[model samples]
Target: MNKNNQKSKDGNWQISFSPIFRYVAVFCLLIFATIMLGGAVLSFSQMKSNAQVLLSNVHAQTSQRIDESITLLESLASLPEFYDPNVPPIEKVKKLDQMSPYFDYLMICYVDSNITVYSDGSEPASLASRDYMQRLFSTGQRQVTDSFAAGADGVTLNYTVAVPLLDAQNNITGCLFCAIYFDEVVDILKQSAATSGYEATLIGSQGQIMSSTAGLPYGEPLMKELQNARVIGTTPDKLQEQLLAAEPGDYWSLQNGSLVYTAYQRVEDTGWDLLCSVDFRTAFLGILPSLLLVAALAALLCLGLSFLLRRYIAGQMHSVDLLVESVEKLEKKLYQDERPENVDFNEIIRLTSDGLSDALTGLVTRSVFLNQAETQLQKINPEYTSALCFVDMDNLKSINDTYGHYGGDVALKNVGYIFREYEKKYDGLVSRYGGDEFVMLLINLDDEAELRSVLEELVLRLHSEIGSAGQQINVQCSVGVSLCQPGMKLEKMIADADEALYFVKQNGKGYYKIHQN
Candidate 1:
């Protein structure tokens, strides 16, 4: 046969075995495969990075919340009422409850070398109070006790704040101690998890989960995992060593063989940690299904185009374009649009806001006020003058006992309002320094006479208001005013004002005392 006839016969055979469309089909299949692979890898990397960032933020935020909670407790301990032996234990409890809404339970203990009293009521008959007291006295610092199963409450942990309560002679009378219920902490963690897309657990130094969201078991396996997790190296040296040495953050496959991303950090100042983990499958839930559909459709289109005319291939390509557009829209809505209800991301936003606000309020508590006052005095020029007024509610306990806590709250709120009003008038800062005690900052008040007059009139107004509320209420406040001088420390002014207040509290309830230079 001639060469032309041979070529025609070969073409017929080739067409019989596989159509020209088959070649096009194979090429399209390869292209779809490549696209799918690239998309999957990119999605995986993005999801992992996002998960890590979320966990990192959760860790930092949890640490801050813990610190703020601890600081609030410490401030409560520093109050003069805690040192006053005459104050009943129940009164102190009520006062603490009033001051801190976050505290679910609080206890004051005097575990001294000689005497011990558990101010939460009474010591358990089965437990040896003396032994615990000895251990506390020896430690001489704040510490968190191990988690133990308390009856009916399941498992509970105790965070103890231990400080020395000094006497007038400057001798340590005993260790002023408080116990925070771990359940409240756990509730906070769960609430955080519910509102912030990440799961959170408070890990102790011993690898025990001191608190965790509801339904998470506090078992050995979980504890071991937390202990082994990878941690941020920027943590304190000891913590860094613990985290690096531990196996907690290591990769683990679930029962069905899914991988998860994990992260953890040590809480600064507190010997606690936060651990967070999320499965990648759940992290990018909807993205995978859509990607699979696109790949499948591409495969089918390639198969059809091989058997049909070129016009069909063009139609298939248009369909592919529409599919791509749909996927893009889904991605944008899922990742970039406003968060949806019951979605993981919304929780994070809410929790972050709550945590930050709580932290700010914690800083504004008594210690920060005192520090700011000291800083202001330190930077004062010779010509500038300031007045410090220590305002004390005369009988907060009696009022609370007589009218209940709500009334006490109302009275305190009124007092805060009054301070705010005066603050506006004097261009000063008024802080609820402690329960039933407030500090007013009056700047550039050089006239001692004018300052005295202002304080007296304020006290008279308070008395008149209290009298109208109820003659029996007779709520009164005593004011102690001290003028800040050049080269004087803020504490000296505070001490002078405190002494003057003490004199008034002794001599008369509703009176003002001004300390002389």
Candidate 2:
């Protein structure tokens, strides 16, 4: 071939490959650009979604905690001795202290006729004869009052809840008052903030900061913003509305020049609002480098694809695969990890495994236990008889008050161990119902004699175990058993058992009673 023809042929080859090269180059650039953009979008969306989910979880957990705490308080309030009018103030204070660990703080103030503060600690001078307390009592409604109360050496914010305690005659007795000191509540807020990766604060119904995790000073700008912001009341519908109405996502700078991404939710039953926020730059800044690196790498890859198409595709596919695998593992860890045996249903299993389990004792929580019991009742075969026993630790609070909460915890754990031991023999499920209360579900307890024998043995074993513990504690429990029958409601069975338990308590301590047929 002539030299000119050879050159022309080579030129044609280059020209033909140019379009393909350009197309490949452009496509690679587009892919890289799309990935970088998509990642940024995904990361932002994930953060937002995660924040929402975390807020939802926080709302649920805190609400549950509050509910549990309140339930404990209500139970204490319902005790005949609490309103006996014969129990001395000092004894009542001691009883309140025994249950104090369940709450951040507690007070048993009287708001009728005069505001007398029967605080667990030193009385706050500013709170003495407070009008808010008077107004709340007269209104016959629960109130959460926020104010600055003078403490021992200084003043601190107070979040006070006033619940009307009713007597057996259905008349309101002195109010059952409880307050959480701002400092202690701040600790809770800080923990929530750390867990959710957000700054958090608890606001009162009037938009006052009852407690704040953020160390930033509360000033005019901050207060103004809080006041102007839409407030969410402690209700499910209101919380949902507040979350939905939140700016799809936005950044706002405080007067002090710190930017934040904030969201709010109302804690149900507590009348307290949870404010979740994170420093905007802190939350988003970490992603910038990866974003930039991806853009840079895309540019380089597009430029180099002219020489190495096969290698590029292989690398991209490998990277994508790894990403997919990582995500799958995360999902597995987050939602599908194996739970312990004996947890029959998925929800119960999840609740048991989750940190929602009580830290004091390795027993199923009240919520989980009740839910599991209900589930078992639903699935129970008519032929397989079961009994629900409600156990109450008599003088448990007295033991705790005398020996301290740590000692109380030890006693409760020992009791749990005894129940577990008894449970083994009877094929029963044992759970710490709450504080000093426990529940045992014994399967196949149809024979009356066998059921009575089990109860007697359980009581004997419990006493023996307590005697061996060598502590200066006198432990006793009251048990009420209700046999599960065909077409019986679980709630009614529990109620019957509870009634029998109360009867045992009234008749004599350290005794067991079965509900009359």
Candidate 3:
């Protein structure tokens, strides 16, 4: 054919395919949009449900801790030594001090009607000015105080769990109180926040923030902080009223240009409220990969239809060059097209695959652990020493062999629990590296002596026997420790710790070793 004739024929084919391509593209786009919208809504609903469950779990745990304090104090109050007039305060304090070892409180003390606080190794101090003490004395009822400075230096924050002591005639004589360090509650909040990617705060009955994982100041009015954030669905005043009325509800707010969802629940038997908040964007992040995959598939379907149309049109024409040119143009367009802007595929990947947590251990996954460790190492203080640890479960295979995989799982769960306890206690990072292996990064240690003491306690705690199917299986672990040095990378520290762990396994299992050189 002549050049003009060929151009006319190619133009005709293009005109014929234009309408079909447009229709297919538009239909695919509509399908993609519908799928994305539905996916987003369902993702948000699932996120809300997850948030509610997390809040409920944290609330129950906080309530249980508070109730435990009250129950312990009440049990102690029933002791005759506390209410007996003949028993001297000094003797009572000695007896209380002996019992203190069994309880988790900082100290157990006896408070007289005059609000005189007496405990072992401390002079009697008058607590007359304390509001909770005054209320307890007046009402002859148990009282739980909010976080307050209680020590001689007036810098230590503590919660007072006090139960009124009654005499034989039912007259109030004195009170039995246990002073709990506020950091204990803070650890609970921190752990829940860390595992769930949320912030947790404990609010006093008077609307004061007793403890917050978000670093909200102690004794700050919860309403004041809410006022600073742009609350949605309700005014801050109404929210404060709901909190004061001990109502459980959820609220959304805009803080620092990010939307946050917060759920509040009242801790039973205490004038306290627990709030759990998370960034709203995270809810969508979990489902983004699926949405992206659906969109990609839709695009491919459209592309495939276009290819079929091109084939049919090419079949009608006798020229092979037109088909080659069309495909070349299509390939160029595919590569030259701009990618979607501002989409963080790395974050999307991280959010998926169990959402940055190990399903079995409830600890951060390896990627998260490495990121956190590197950040902390960069900011490490010279005055404090930090240590990295490699832990290997020694009896996992044996447990699985004898009692089945269920027993092995139980043993690993116990290890997770033990590691988490230490993580909270030491403010460390813990992660499950892979099968039967875990890593821990403990920062801000006072000295090697303190690290040694911690390792000793950890080893002792890990050497317990767990029961499986009416049979006792001994569960143990070997730990390898490496003290972090200046300018050391995470990989090197992990290698050192692994070497130490190898030494322990070679020498004797169920022990710990510090890396040498």
Candidate 4:
């Protein structure tokens, strides 16, 4: 019922909960995202390393096989029967039969002659037409060649290792040749890739596909396929450029919405590239289940944390909620002598007392100013001169039209800011009444000259500083001042100021006027 009792009741309500919890949650989410990104990076690196090691092993195994085949051909050349010109033709042919079980096929061709010998006991084919045999005869040297051979059955693709035979006088005698089926070598490349789920290819020196477990047609120019394919994360043109410069290493690209990790090794002995690749989704099959489990656990943790945080926040504000309910009961009784029971909070009442301050300008709201101003005025001496001023911004609408409503808000805030300065200097109350409007009450003006001086200083300071709020509009205001009288209700006093403000609007704006009545 009394002012002091009302103040005591207000003090019982305590406010809690800092506003920074939202920012804390956002920061935690950022940390989680960073961790997931790092995990993904490490996963890809490990998979790529596995691919590189597998490809290198395939290169080593293939190279070793080639060396063994060359050694076999050189040992076969040591036998004397084929090189000795004194031996009978039937016996030398029998020596060729002795070479059986060593090579898949064997041939002996005399130097500067088309006569040929075979260990298979099949009909002899002329070796003069074969490019590889011609080279052996003319150069009298050892050679390896990959080409189609004309056999009695038909032309067959073959890989051959050949050696020259020399007479005792160091003159050319004949040549020794051993052959392996091309399909047999293809089986070797396929065996290396069998269990790994990787597709393998043998790329020729001419950029063609000699053999492939990928089902590409043999002898097709592989560069045409690389150039025409659409590779993800890059245009087709750029992908072709990269493929041309691709070397013996590992690389990544996307195919069919899945990442592919490819590894290649150059077979220096054969002038070829051995390509092997595995898909990322298939390679990481064991890891995805684990990653999903981790992601699910993280989601549960976040949800549990959110639930506990909300309960904690509610518990902190329990006293404030009760105080609000008590205020509602007090309002219904029409200022009764009975007071509500007080809660036991100390500093929270002070924290909430000024919560109604304007967010933009730090001035109090109209209701807060009116409630506190009456009490402030009660202590003022009637003999001392005082004034209440109402202020309305002049260029707000134009500012909004020119630079949008944000600029209009900046203009109103500029005017409120000036009122705040006057409030601090002259020890009065300033409140943002509504949009583009503010009210000021100076308790002890001393004289009209002091009021006039303060108003002039506010106008000059506002004009100089308002445009710096970063909007491209000039700021100005119109004001009306009403002198307070003894026993004047605040409502009547404010109305008097409003009437003066209306008169300023009627005439030229951008200036202040006093109440005539």
Candidate 5:
């Protein structure tokens, strides 16, 4: 061949390969960009999920603590002794003083029909001017107050729960109340904030801060804080509307020139909200390591694809198609929200209701049980006795090992059904306290003999068989009972019952024992 012709063919080959290299580089860049974008989205979504879980856990814990105060006051109201006119004021005061330690309140007090407050170690003082007092006496209903100056110190911020004392005819007689120090609640928020890297604030219905981990003043309006910080996703007014309506949501904002992400949820059965906030930059950095790892893998994959494209130019189109498909699958896998946003108040309410009951056993969860049981315990007639029963499924582990977890689950379902029936029959409170254990509050039993009879029925009923995997598994529970008095604390009763249960487990299983203490 001529030298010119040879040179021309070599140049043409070089030009052909150059465009292919450009296309390969462009494709690799596209792949890298797609992976990085997906990784970022996934990281942000994950951060939000973590924040939500933290917010939810803190909210539930705080709400439960507040609910106990209400339950304590309501329980005090049901003591017939408190309503008795003949019971001297000094005697009532002494009785309240004795029960003070058990109630975990700053003070347990009695307010008569005249709205005079008589507390342990304090002189009689009229609470007639308190709005909560006026409301309870006028409507004969329960009241949970916002933070205010209370207790003998009369300077420390406190919240109060008051219930009207009703006589035999259901006529309003007086009020039984308890005061919860505000700092105790703030401690709960502080602990959560310290561990979770999110500052938490408890807000009352009027938008005032009840407690805050961020060191916001106790009575400052939340809006005032917002006014100083710029909200990114929505206006302060809109956020206030959401708060006023007790809606659950998340938002972005800028505080002191730093990006912030916040989530808020309404505390159930109370006119309060829980707000959790975290520094956006700091939280984003948490997931940066994972993103970098993903990016490194993507870069290596891009290099491999480049080599394949250079060697197998004929099948480059097919390789690109496969790459696109993989990217789409990754987008689907990475970008999912753990909890869908609630579009309306009704949807939020529905979601809240879903968590109140246990999914597998169809019984109230431990927290729900605590709240309901305390309220019911207070309403029982003082003339009759009540009992707290701790029930442990004796053969759950054996059943799980023998017939698999399905068999153990079948046993629990049966037990739950039985306990639920008893709850309806006795008008009692029943809860699945933990794995393979349950708690029941049997109210208004006439005497120890009556309780024994009821327990016998429960034991015999629980001593049945359940079918699992084409075989029968015997399911039995050991019961420990603690008789309850008017002034007894729920935790003390639980502990006593648990001790008795320990005795039954150690001596023999599948039987019942009353607490000796």
Candidate 6:
């Protein structure tokens, strides 16, 4: 209040406002510093939280896949080869061989030989020498193993899911086995990381990276092979200890000179850890410009700058507010992953049928069948075989003439309905090739007897009278069947099947015949 100064040249009273300006400037600088530093801390906190959630998601998904794999193997073990009393050994080999694209290496091991079955053909070998086969014989229940270098594609890490194929006397006749490459899993983890800005890795029991999108190179032991793993928290030995522990946790470490915050959870039922890391430097980079602006404002305050600096500082603070708001928006979007990574993996059925589903029949189209079946044939593993059936509806024109279009539609729909039922029952792919014509592709059929019986049953069902649009119409179909030979083109197989069906049509209207070639 004390105006102990003289008047300025104009008319205004001028006092030294330096001391008060310094105090007010310092206060403003403190507020600016708080905004900058506090936001960095908050950002890091959000990042760590997000990392934890993401890692948990990755772990849950992996565990679910493992469980699903085991359940599938268990169901497969109950099939004719494994459990049915009267199923002959050769027939068992046939049954086991028909597993589709899913069974990378399917086998039924007897005391004498190991029979490998695939969609292409079968191979008889001494499979008892294989480590996985031996392991399944010992474990008895469903088991999964990793990095087992027993695959044909040289030496790459793969996850093997297996179950003991047993006899009715509860004795192990052999084992049913399949392998999934770890790369498939890595792709899934990468999807999660891309959405949430996290790095993921799967560490084995001995601390080796079984699968990884971060940290030491995959296949190398994490503890011994860690390149430039600088310490961020505890000593190197303790860091190794904590990481190797099969528990859920969060920790800090430095990799390649950048400090990183890490969270990890163990994959249930395996010696694998699902780890996620958030880089401290990257996560907190948003605070740098604000801090620099605040430091400049503090310097201006020291110089006793007034109106210009005040206006500039206000604008900078507003920009900082906008930046903070943007980051918060980002954090929200990253955490909620729709179904939080409800991943429905696309598995195109390699059927010799069409791709697009017929709206009326709700089955695949003809073109889809051919393209996929070709792919399936190309990937044929020895001991695997496929069957192709060409079904020609008899007297469809007559049905159309008698009942008009609606009645004909009913007859066609009935054929599709029966085909779909068999498709689901035998795990085959069937399609509506055209009006009143249907194509059925049966992969991994070990026994022609079973396939014949199924076709015979389906024909009977097709012949059943359907009351539609106030009419009873019997659907008779001519069937042609062809078994795929090794190195056989799907186009050739389809032709043979069509020819066989032509024979059936020429001979009698409603009977099925196997191509005698």
Q: Rate the local accuracy (lDDT) of all candidates.
A: 0.59, 0.62, 0.81, 0.66, 0.78, 0.68
Candidate 6: misplaced stretches above 4 Å?
1-9, 15-26, 84-99, 102-119, 155-157, 225-227, 232-245, 286-517
Worst 10 residues of 6 by lDDT: 339-348
lDDT of 5 by residue, 1-517 (tens): 0011212332321124677667767876787677667766665676577678779779878778767877776777777788777988778888887776786677777888899987655688888898888888888888877788865576888877777888889888888777777777878888877886678888987999888878898789999999999888689999999988888998988887767778899987668889888775556576668777777787677678767866786466456556656755643442343211211223322434777877766678899999988887777777787899999999899999998887777788778777866875677888889999999998877777888999999999999876655687898899999998779999999999999999999998899999986
Superposed by TM-score, candidate 1 places the C-alpha of residue 254 at a distance from the truth, in angstroms, of 7.0
TM-score for each of the candidates: 0.42, 0.44, 0.55, 0.50, 0.50, 0.48
Model 6, span 61-88: residue lDDT tens: 8898777766776787776645554655
**Candidate 4 segments whose C-alpha is farther than 4 A from its true place:** 1-51, 85-115, 147-157, 166-172, 194-196, 230-265, 277-294, 307-517
TM-score ranking from best to worst? Answer: 3, 4, 5, 6, 2, 1
lDDT of 5: 0.78
lDDT leaderboard ranking:
3, 5, 6, 4, 2, 1
The TM-score of candidate 4 is 0.50
State in Å the error of residue 244, model 2. Answer: 16
Q: What stretches of model 3 exceed 4 Å from their correct place? A: 1-3, 6-35, 297-517
Runs off by more than 4 Å, candidate 1 = 1-32, 43-48, 100-136, 149-172, 175-181, 187-201, 210-241, 244-256, 284-286, 289-309, 312-517
Which one is best on TM-score? 3
Report the CA-based lDDT of candidate 6 relative to the real structure.
0.68
lDDT of 4 by residue, 388-474 (tens): 888888777877898787666666655665575577557788898887788998876677787788777766655543443454568
**What 10-residue stretch in candidate 5 is worst by lDDT?**
1-10
Error of 5 at 312 (Å): 16
By lDDT, the better pick of 1 and 5 is: 5
Ten contiguous residues with the weakest lDDT in model 2: 1-10
Query: RMSD in angstroms, candidate 6?
Result: 46.7
